[model samples]
Target: MTALAVGCPYPPCTVPTRDLQPIRHSELRMDTHHRGRVLTLRRIAPVVKLTARSWTVTQESSSGGTERLEVILHRSNHGQDILESESMFMVKEPYYTLSDQGDPTLRIDHPSDLVVCTGSLGNDISCPSSGEPGGAVAATAFAAPVTNTAKECKDEGNAALKQRALPRALAKYTNGLQLVAKDTAANGSIACDLHRNRAYVNLLLNRLDEAKADGTASLTGIKDQEHQDLDAKAYFRTGHAAYNLGDFQEAKSLFEEQQRLAPSDRDAIAYLRKTEVRLHEQATGEYDFRKIRAGLSKTAPRADAASFDRNTEVKKSPGRGHGLFATRDMDVGEIVLCEKAFCVVWGHEDEALTVMTYDVRDDMIRGFPAGLCKAIVQKVLNNPSQIEKVMDLYGDYQGIGKHLIMRDSGPVIDTFKVHDIVARNAFGPGPVYSGGPRAEEDVRNASTGLWIRASYLNHSCVSNSKKEYVGDLMVLRAARPIGAGEEITHSYNESGDYDARTAALKTTWGFACTCALCLAEKADGTALRTKRRALELEADAWAEVEHAAKAKRISIVKARCLARSINDTYEDVRYNGLPRTALLRIRKWLTEATTRDLAGC
Candidate 1:
């Protein structure tokens, strides 16, 4: 077996005397010891089994410090080494095993835990030269040793936190936690304080699960009246974690407990309101969209809205990877789903925040839509438990179904993988924009977000549903009655000639739309295309005249006649029940004109 030592050195006595040896099928053993503090194992080896017995030190160091083992698995690809998985184990219980398991690659208990890969790696892949992997590493697992007393470590942690050195503070808090003995009432109270403080740090670090665990742990084994403040904070932190984790009921319960403890706490009061709003949204798909939209900010682009709907489900589509299908019959104009974006970049306020990368090979400009990849990466980094929201969506990345590995520093994430997902799945600034040739252009220039469930609804020219956006919230409504088990689809583009629509879909989504409307247009051949071209020209000429007519500078009667003439062109069975771009424009203008005329009423 081969091993590479990494991380800072510890006192000789703190180092385990025995070596971590490879375990066979039924036997575990310890081998020769290395003087270094950290060990690295390559999966290329037949069986790399690391057990904790050989890694823990028996004698307490002079500083009363301890060391925990963190295992980080990485895979090298495209000259970049990205994290595959990470895990932390206490020194006394560090047993972990990795095997080829018939596939001759990698196999673990939790296959879905691995980060999505951009593509298959070549045989020449190599690890990075640095000892530590970069990006959002957890600080608690390898904290420096501190004095044995819990109070001293807690004080040090508090001081570090005040200085805004989060990672250092986490180390101190973790060290204090290790020294705490929770057997007695006084000691347990001290333990509670340490747990609550540590939970706050974890909450800041975006380690939601750890924060909740610590917060809940702090609430137990103590009932001191003097510690009410600490208990209140613990409840608040746990509630925040649960809320972000989409557990509204638990969050509400936790927040209510905090309120009971700290009646006048304004923060607790604020969270209770947000929790109630989410609860209401979950129960009923109604929302005050205008209020939500007006609430967007640089720090808070999306509200803590509930993404709730039970009418649809995800299932594999024959050609598409997956698609959303109606689980129950839906009536026209009924809400299909109302989903909050996984991440959104608001462009209306910050028009300069866009990132565009031109693909030389593909001969197309791929819009990153305001560097949303960074937002996604930061979101996953903060609350890694929600990574499934980003990873399970469609992307060019082929690496999936791998187990997740966590390191002490944090979960290893590949920005490129996230970038690929964002580029492929992000939707525009808003669903409603100006119509005509400029509509696609308007969508391209607006804000964009990744809505996981909504992405599964495939595209159709004459779609069964229509989607609208309110801030980052996406509301899908049935445009026509849909039957149970019917696949939900919506048009991805504005109304245009068949050639323009097909070309746009092919260039943007890489799929030639084969919807019934397109098939009918295709079967009509050249004569139909010629007639449509003539109508398009006539409409363009009439549009100029209609604008003058609306301004009262031309005869409105001529404009009305021209509009009726265009509407009659689509009266054929071929265009029946399908979107008529020409008629839609005319109807929109007439409706607006009638509304203006009725203002006095």
Candidate 2:
């Protein structure tokens, strides 16, 4: 609910200060203390002038009292302002309280409310800089004679590539291509090398379409009997682009061409084999899942070999956005779909990957692994072709226009949109284990990934389908028999009671679930609800001590009694065949206890 406390302060501002009119007013809510009261924040002050990013202003409140608002703007490296507004409003009347003690802080909660900076003083204000942004830089790079400029750009791009500065490297390579003439045979060698090298860089950056075009041009520019090795390299690069774009058959042909040019090229041979595997998986929805899982410890592709989606199709749902539906009848326990993650972050060894980020405006704290947001952004930047697949996903920042900041080197991405998208769509870092049950701490730091198609499967308390993760692959299976054209659903929050499930869904996904199970639980009498809560708590307590009791071979009657109590709470007609998540473990415990007692007799 406040500005970022961590950062290297900008070199002292020499620019003159002018009156700052509050250009925006973000609506506020304090969920912990407001009891669902939405407050509309209106600025009564005409203007406030300050020399720094942080300023304090006196404002007239709705209650006709003076309120002091302290606004601090933290300028991110991506050229967006993280606005922290702390308002201490005067209270004239008793407001309905959600807490016994009052909360003085007010917050703006959405990313769109935070201003996109042209030059750091929020939007609509520009900071003074020494040079014209991208134009001046580009002009200077091309000022030299065309041939000399081409050579200079090629050398600079190679150096940047070695340093792993991808965007800078891409800019240099592009500059070289602009100056080099492609028509003449005399310049063909230089042009060929430039296109081939640029294609390689594009492949590294995941700009597959650009890479494919450049690779094709590199091959075309080669005169007969000139650069046999270059031809092989060109084919290899183009093959990869096609492979990544899911054109496996074309990729196979390209790789075979590369092999014909250079039989001993190991990289080409390996990728050719991979292409064949992808072709096989594409034809039949089958894979060596065991091999894929075992390969998790080694460095491998972030995407799995194939996306098996033959059983489903995306179609419009009534109230919700597009949802995944079964295209054919599927039996219970049958695999419905298997897809690879678009991006994922998995912690190593004892590393706790989850990082907590404070959203000052929203007064919300969200946590994800440190590089997860950057990973997604970089993935999109590398392959601008896939930008729509990511941007089309549901987010809080929809309808907000361009946030990308143009820079001399390349476009500086605004990660706020990606951050919001990940928060809504990602799954993992818990309930995912490679082997046996892990400690709670290990489970908390597990792995997380975004599966675009999987996100389309909406939430339901008693879902028709269930999802499991293996490496980066998301495997969806029908929990109950699903008919043709049936919309598949999965429980978003399966661990909690009715209230907890509803609250989690509303807080995390921004929707109240009105599924059959949720509705039934809501209409359940108050007495029954109270009894169920008490019984669930008792079962939890028993679970905590069950392992220790089992080591001592203690009587299992309490486990049996707890299981019975849980089962009785769920009505037979309403909850039949639906997963009673609360009762599952208890029944297992009772079964184990009965087996042990019988063995002793």
Candidate 3:
């Protein structure tokens, strides 16, 4: 028999604890003492077991863009239904060793208690069995500890609230929440206050899930009764958000509780009635939510997606080596592909490091929980080509990360490859940015992840596709229609002019722009260059158009003609649209010129 102190390396893995001890399986353990509680274990021969099942995949074009896919997994062959259908899972009755209605020894309490992983291509199925201690972590877990005082953060939030600066208020509340979680500056009341305030702000900002989470936190873990009134606010606002989000049952429960705590609140009464009406409507199927859904779809393009459309494939592209290409006509908002991340790092670290070392970046991958690290390592090792694919990204790993990255450390080569892949392709610690070259600011705030399928997208100033990150999953959606055999591309940056666009792309990704627009701009002769310079001037400098006239020493008349032409048809740039900005500037300049009686006008 052997006992060893070990970090848990199994399911229920989102928890970190220092007290866990791993024991040999052959040595069945007896009960242990913990604050005067007795713990027991039962045999597994009569207990439940899971078997590998069939996997299925479905594909469709995403409303938000990109080819989309949905995968369904099925499990069968248990003799009878284990648990009630209303619970989190439908286990066969024959497999039940416990019951939800009686003893919940091996059962889920309710359907609402269902836990699912929100990140891409992974399951939250890791749970380590250790008689040690444990604590929870969120999807956005980071290595940094909060340093600000809860009171200081709350006071700042109060100031922001006074100014109606909703975003600022949210930031302050979050800072306080982080401080509380890190145990650096918060007491129970401050924690409650932080959660309650953050819930209200989240409601105002229409972040329904975060509002619900904060509201739940505010109500729970309140050891003090002095702040029940604040808790009531959290309940009411959470209910309000639930109602708006169409969770009628949850809204009903939340509103009722709030009304009990604040008996004379009319808003709670109204909400209660509204929730009842909605519940009835839902039971009778009398509500057609399609219209609300349609309206949301119009505005929800900011963050949405899908993938797995076979109309696209990865293949060698001219000058670009490899790229994703469409094999058939695809409509806008169609999802083209879905990919799971290979390795992900939560935040950045600064140390005694050099630019070429990339050690901090490597730590991002190597720092994952032990079980997760093994799973990720095994995944790449299982497919050696995946490592090669990652290595083929942009810059040479040796040229940049050789000093430390390639050291004889275990999995060093694998970590270096993943880091290179993420450095070239990672997106989002925030919502999608249509702009180019993200992740340069404060690496501590950046989240780096690798998506093999998404890496196939090549650069285009006028890309036909865009990507969205749902956790570690990468979904590429079509920005516009595409014909068969067309290569899929996404802008490395938001739309910019020839010089700015090329410079940004070159500096960020080490690529030269040879697109049609670039070639056309290269043909600019002296007169055309003068027109372009005037066209590029800021709105306040509309008078600069006369500089074209000053060149070649011509009259204001010729200058006006050149200005009108330049303004009307600088046809080959990113911001071109109806009612061009240049034309608007020209109109302003023309009005001023006419008032001055310039012959050019």
Task: For candidate 2, list the clashing residue pairs, or say none.
Answer: 108-361, 108-362, 109-361, 109-362, 429-447
Best by lDDT: 2
lDDT of each: 0.59, 0.60, 0.47
The lDDT of model 2 is 0.60
Between candidates 1 and 3, the one scoring higher on TM-score is 1
Q: What TM-score does model 1 achieve against the real structure?
A: 0.66
What tens digits encode model 2's per-residue C-alpha lDDT throughout 1-601? 1123211111111111111121111222333322212222223343332211322233332333333232322211122222322122111111221221243333222221222212111111111111333112222221233343677778888898899866556666776676675434336566677788889888886778889988988885344544667898899999999898778899999999888888999988999999889877766768888877766542442445778888988888889988999999999988899887787766543223455555554565555443455566656655556667777777666533344333322333334556667778888734434542334544335566788888788888888998877767788899989999999999888854777778788766768898777877877777887788889888878876777335334446566667778878889887765667678666666655534543321
Error of 3 at 378 (Å): 12
Q: Which is superior by lDDT, 2 or 3?
A: 2
Q: Return the top candidate by TM-score.
A: 2
Candidate 1 lDDT, 161-241, residue by residue in tens: 999767657767776776675434347767788889989988887678889989999985345655777788899999999
Ranking, lDDT, top scorer first? 2, 1, 3
Error of 1 at 40 (Å): 11
lDDT of 3 by residue, 259-317 (tens): 87778889989889878866764454233333323322212312111123366788899
Candidate 2, poorest ten consecutive residues by summed lDDT: 8-17
Q: Candidate 1, overall lDDT?
A: 0.59
TM per model?
A: 0.66, 0.69, 0.34
